[model samples]
Target chain A: MIAALLESFAAAARGLPLTLAIWGAGVATGLALGFVIGAVRFFAPAALSWPLAAVVEAVRGVPFLVQCFLLYFGGPFIGIDLTPIVAGWVALSVYGAAYFSEVFRAGFMAVPPGHLEAARMLGIPRNQAVLRIMLPMMALAVLPSLANLAVILIKETAILSIITVPELTFRVQGVGSATFAFAETTLVLALVYWALVEATAVASRHAERRIARALAA
Target chain B: MSAPILSVRALERRVGDVEILRRIDLDVMPGEAIGVIGPSGSGKSSLLRCIAGLDEVSGGAVMVEGRQTRPGDGAVGMVFQQFNLWPHLTARENVALALKLVRRMPAADAAAKADAALARVGLGALGGRKPAALSGGQQQRVAIARTLAMEPRVLLFDEPTAALDPELTTEVLDVIRDLAAAGTTMLVVSHEMGFIARLSTRVVFLDHGVVVQAAPPAALFGAQAEPRVRSFLQTYLDRVAWARDA
Candidate 1:
């Protein structure tokens, strides 16, 4: 069992780069889309706002695994051929973007009306005010939520194993099946995920404290 | 006297189903310090918001230097009661943001101007600090410095010292008084009767979204007041007198 666990650990570690790449790509795409969606919801006309609202609401209400299955299995029916990695990126991006949209919305809303008024009074253009004053402040307000989303995205990368992506979780499953060492392989996978989340949480806490001190200053 | 720096003619504002301000007509002259005093629900802040172009006037118009005040026109400078300094920015950076973004000043020039504005407010040494690091009064001063850096012809303040302790309130009021001395045209909404008495050239008394009395502070505080004005003064004076003795 010990030897099997060591072999599984090495196999999983080999797939670490792929896991990080998926997380990076998915988060980047999700963040961009989320920002655009959140801004429209906050500032666009009701006609435009309603559609974006529907998209966020529908996506958020469904389970992420179901969304991933739909992207993977449902794509071929629509005449679109997507590899498992592509399907995982699509699913995670959609799922993360919906959650991030709400986070950005709350951050923008937390900004006081007085700040906008002060900017306008100083002759800052409306777009300039949003860029210089509103966006920076909102970014600070939403940092913690963004950090949480990142950690969740990292964990969710494991779900890609269902579609046969050669990620950490998939490697662990493969080694366990080959060696018939289910408990040992599963324990190693669990430890890997635990370390990843713990490191992320510690970094996030440190960044939040630094930002809070900067904001207070 | 020089032409009025700001003019509001029959201004009205409605928020939702309720009318917040009605038929507000006023002329603010250059270098004049005017105090707007009113009860809690009298729309004093809303009136100032209209003047600052923070809110649209439902009816009538506001003309600054003969040009209509439009969104992002950058005519007036405003200081809010909450001292809305950007928390992520240092005092100098907060003050410079308007200059850099609005006035399109060079970075070095904006920084120099921000430093000067901070110095003017007696915050030169603390320009590196952020709003959270500063006390309430210091935050308010940073807000003022941010406004003053814009070089606005007219300044509007909405309840500038409402959230400060007595000592901090005095510190902020001193900055306002100095602005008045520098001949900045100011339209201020404040509940500080003592500051109004000492600094205001004209005092506008508002009640229930209407201007009940527009007079010198002395007339509003003295025996010449209307019965309504007398009652308002009595309540205000009683509070101040008690606060002073205590």
Candidate 2:
């Protein structure tokens, strides 16, 4: 069982690159979309904010698996063809964006209204005020939430295996099916996921410290 | 006299159904310090906000040097009651922001000017410190320095020392006196009667959104004044005396 576990770990290790591919692409795309949507919802007039809020709520209301299946299997029915990897990216990005937008919105709200007004009173243009004052303040306020979202996204890449994206779970499941070492394979998968989360947390801590030091200057 | 450097004409401010300020008209001339004083909820701050262009006036206009302009037009600088120093920035950076943005000064020159501004306010050695690290008075001084760096034609202060205790209030008032003596044009909204008496060339007494009287400190603070104004001043003085004893 020990030898089988070691072999399964090696097989799963090969899938790391693909797993990382989905997580990286998904998080980056989601963050960009999230910032835009979040800013619109938080800062835009009610005429625009209400519709964006509805979209965010709708996305967050559904389960990730249902959303994934809809994109991957539902695509062909709509005359849209997408590879498993492409579908995985789309589902992960959309799911992550719904959650991330809320995180960013809360971050913007945390900044005191007085600070923004003071910036404007000092003749800092609106766009520059948002960029130089609002964004940096929001970033620090939202750092921990952002780090947590990254961890959630990392773990969520496992869902991509359902679409046969050949990520860690898909490959590990393949090894288990062939060798009948279900328990051993499961243990190895758990360890890999744990290590990934730990690494993310460590990296987040380092980033936070660096940001603090930079702001101190 | 030559046209006032800053002018507020028929300024009215309404928030929802409530009128925060109405029919407020005042003019601040060069080398003059106008003190605006009134009891709580009397719309003193709102009037100042209108002049600074911080709040939209439902009616009327604010003219800076004969030009209709908005708040932050590089013509008027304001020091807030809370100081409102950007918490993440050092004292120097706070002072440098408008210089870089409005004056378009190079980074090096802005830093040097920021240093000189800080020095002007007796904060030269504390420029590297953040607001959170400084005392309340020091933070307010930094806010004043930040405004001064803009080299505004008129400075507006909204209860500049309201948030401080007695000791800190003295420190901030001392800075204002220096500016007053230096002939900087200013419009100050303050609750501190002594500070207002010492620094103002003219004192505008406000009550219920109207300018009850605009006169020198001596004429207004003297025994003969409007009944409402006299009563308000008596209450303020009584409160101070009570606070000191308590």
Q: After superposition, how far is residue B229 of candidate 2 from its true place, in Å?
A: 2.1
| Candidate whose DockQ is highest | 1
The residue ranges of model 2 lying beyond 4 angstroms of the native Cα positions read: B240-246
| Candidate closest to the true structure, highest TM-score | 2
Task: Give the range of the ten consecutive residues with the poorest summed lDDT in model 1 chain B.
Answer: B68-77
Per-residue CA lDDT of model 1 for A1-217, tens digit only, reads: 7799899889889988898888889999999989889888999899999999998999999888788888788889998679999888888888889989999989889999878877777777889888878888887889889989988889999999988888999988999999899999999999999998898789878988787665554
Count of clashing pairs, candidate 2:
0
**TM-score of B chain for each model?**
0.96, 0.95
DockQ per model, Cα = 0.67, 0.61
Q: Per-candidate TM vs. native?
A: 0.94, 0.94
Q: What is the TM-score (0 to 1) of candidate 1?
A: 0.94
Compose the digit string of candidate 2's lDDT tens values, residues B1-246: 588898888888898998888888888889999999998888988887887778888998889889987777878888999898888889999999878987899989999999999999999999889888999999999999999988888888999998999899998999999998999999999989988988999999988888998999998888756788898899777887998999
Per-residue lDDT for B30-79 in model 1, tens only?
89999999889898998988887778779988999989886556678888
- Give the alpha-carbon lDDT of every model: 0.88, 0.89
Expressed as tens digits, the lDDT of each residue in A1-217 for candidate 2 is 8878988998888999999888999999999998888999898999999988898898899888888888899989998779999999988988888899999999999988878888887889989888888888888888788778988889888888888999999999889999999999989899999999999889988998798667644
Lowest lDDT sum, 10 consecutive residues, model 2 chain B, at: B220-229
